[model samples]
Target: MEESKSGTVRAVDRALDILLCFTDTTDLGLTEIAEKTGLHKSTVFRLLASLEAKGFVTRDSSTEKYKLGFRIWELSVNLSQGDDPATILLPEMERLRDILGETISLYIRDGSERIRIQAVQSKHSIRRVAPIGARLPLYVGASSKVLIAFADMNTQENMINDWKEFIDISAYKDQMAGIRKVGYATSVEEREPGVAAVSAPVFNRSHQLVAALSVSGPLNRLTLENMKDHAGLIIESANRMGNMLR
Candidate 1:
């Protein structure tokens, strides 16, 4: 029974190896997969057949090459939705909101925009409010800037080029350096007039930037001095969320 279990484990490993071989390359033929995985062509073919049956892979009718299928993407989306940072960090967000007496939000990068995945509204009679799933430009706002500040250089350059009319690319780049140094970002009326925010990046287990945590309120309440004072608290809360995720 132990020998049988060991064989099954090996088979599972080989199957995963076959799936992972498509990570970089777009498509692969039977011989290519076999070579990459160091598995026999017959074994590769068998594995491909099994994966194909499960909708994890597909073969092109014309090219006879295999590529990951829509089902794989569907599963990935489901997994990501299930383990969303917004759901996992709600307690931290609530704590930050309580501490700062401002609206707290969690945002994730979405192409050229950042989407508010979760939010805790402030109790004050007059407070800034952004609905959950609100999409905002990547080149503006504290949360947005935090996302851009940690993004790859190529992504930053592209975004700057895209928003050059609204922002000075060189100046933005300089600010990004400071934000990285301080481990957080602040914006005063950058996106919405009379509003100010302080934001920090949140990382996953792999240390990849996954989201931004932000506290926002009216300019009168979230003054520059107040933002500076609360920056450390926001950063600490963000770090706590990152640790939990990791």
Candidate 2:
């Protein structure tokens, strides 16, 4: 019985390995999985069958290839959410998206990078997409500015002093201070051409910066003036989310 249990464990381990082979790569065929896992194609097929039955994977009939399924995303959402601020903030983000008809995103600083934790793209054909799981520089963009504006003094100085591009450091420091003073920031083509965004900081009960909530869209729709016009709305939404997070 012990030997049988060990065999079952091994089968489960191999099945997990097959699933992991799809990591970073979107789709894979049976032969590709077999080669990647060094397992027989028959074994891979059997494991995939179990994974498919449980909704952990799906197979494309046209391509005869498999991809990670909806269940994977569902599980990963929970995994990525430590304090689950995204869940707490998503409703307000959706509200902002509905009101402005622009892409709404939530970004959190991870070391020197800002990561988009959640996003709701605008329904318009000419929309800007802020893909979730994207890691961007922590020193540019409206979102990046708002985040640094609320950061600790030392961190702010360290980041600015290490500026990756040539700019007036004194003026940039003043700009960051203005963001903190006014409660929001706006940018036009600062990070990407023809893209504009406004970002506001969200704080918890302790008044610590939790994230930056932003609305981004095409330049025509979210020009500097337009982004400023949307600033009040995003600031209000960010505060609402902060209240919930607190």
Candidate 3:
């Protein structure tokens, strides 16, 4: 019975190893999994089969490559329903998306980078889309500016003083000034080329900056004139989302 329990634990570990291998890579073949996990091909295949049986993975019949399955998404939705920053913010984001007809995004400050936590894209043909997991420097995008504007003074100074990883020092003061004066920050073709974005900070019940809400699109739709026109609406949506959290 002890040996049986040990074997089961090992099997679970191997299965988890297979899942971990897919984190950074979108898809993987059996051989790639076996090589990356340092497991025998037969063991890898068996573990993958078990994962697939439980709906944790799916193998494409045509490509023979394995990717995450709908069950994973379902579980993610369940887990995020309570704890995700996106879950708390998406409804307001959707409303903003509907009104602006541009992509709306939520970003969280992660270390020295800002990560996209959630987004709603426009149905328009020429929409700007930033993948949910995408990460950017803490000084580039409007979301980053929002984060920086609200960050503790020590962190703000350290990040800006780190000259190696960041350029455009002059923009830091300008960004801070704009974010303070306008209650939001604008990224006119700053982060992604040909894309413009505006971001506002979200405050929690504690009045701490927890996230940022943003609107983005192609240059034609996100021009200076258009951004100025939509700025008030975007700020209002962000304020509503912040109020909801409180």
Candidate 4:
């Protein structure tokens, strides 16, 4: 019985690793999956077959690559159905959107990245639009930085280590300190050229950082001075949402 349980656990771990290998990309061929998971092609194939059978993965016939299936989305939706932050924050986001005439978004931490759970588009003909369900790196963008700044020290260190290849981790110390001191953050074309954003952290009933609320748009409309001017409003909105959650 012990041996059977151990084997089952290992298989589950392998399966989860396979699923995670799809994080940075839209699809992966068998060989790519095997390389990423460090499993033999045959072993990876077997795992993929099992996952495919359970609707956890799907294969594209034309490209012969696998991608996450609808079942995974269904599970995520079900898990979030009860206390999804987006449902609670949309009204505040809309209000901010109207007040600033820019795109507003709600983001939650997911590993070393932040995922957009809600968004309201800007009214401008040219604007930044980060769609719901989009995943962005933790080391870039104002929303992502707000989440990272409020995360625990261990998480902060891990993210900085993971992203050291692309960013100077040392440069973030003062930025994060300022965010904590002022309760907000800002970015100008850090993640995408010609875009700028301001963000504030939101907390839950227990005073835990749960999400970030951000206002973003084209650089022309979201210039440094304008973003600084709107920072207080964004922080106020985030505080109100945090109170509502509590």
Per-residue alpha-carbon lDDT of candidate 1 for residues 1-246, written as tens digits (9 for 90 to 100): 222355666767888899989755779999999999999999899989999999999999899999998888888666754466777899888888887889999999889988898999999999988688677888888898899899888987888789978988889899999999999999988988899999999987778898999999899999899999998888889889998884
lDDT tens string, model 2, 157-181? Answer: 8888888475579999999888889
lDDT of each: 0.88, 0.87, 0.83, 0.88
Which residue pairs overlap in candidate 3's backbone? none
| Highest lDDT scorer | 4
Give the clash total for candidate 2: 0
Look at candidate 2 and tell me the lDDT of residue 66: 98
Least accurate 10 contiguous residues by lDDT in model 4: 1-10
Give the TM-score (vs. native) of candidate 3: 0.76
List the candidates' TM-scores in order: 0.66, 0.71, 0.76, 0.77
Task: Tell me the deviation in Å of residue 238 in model 3.
Answer: 0.7
Which 10-residue window of candidate 3 scores lowest in summed lDDT? 1-10
Candidate 3 C-alpha lDDT tens digits along 1-246: 222355666777778889988756789999999999999999999888989999999999999999998788888766735646688788888888988899999999888888888989898988887688777888688888888888887878787888545677677667686677888888877767899988888887678888988889998888888888888898788778777784
Which pairs clash (backbone N, Cα, C closer than 3 Å) in model 2?
A: none
Question: Residues 29-130, candidate 4, lDDT per residue (tens digit)?
Answer: 999999998999999999999999999999999999999998899897667544778897888899999999999999999887789989999888888877
Who is ahead in TM-score, 1 or 4? 4
Better of 1 and 2 by lDDT: 1
lDDT of 4 at 170: 80
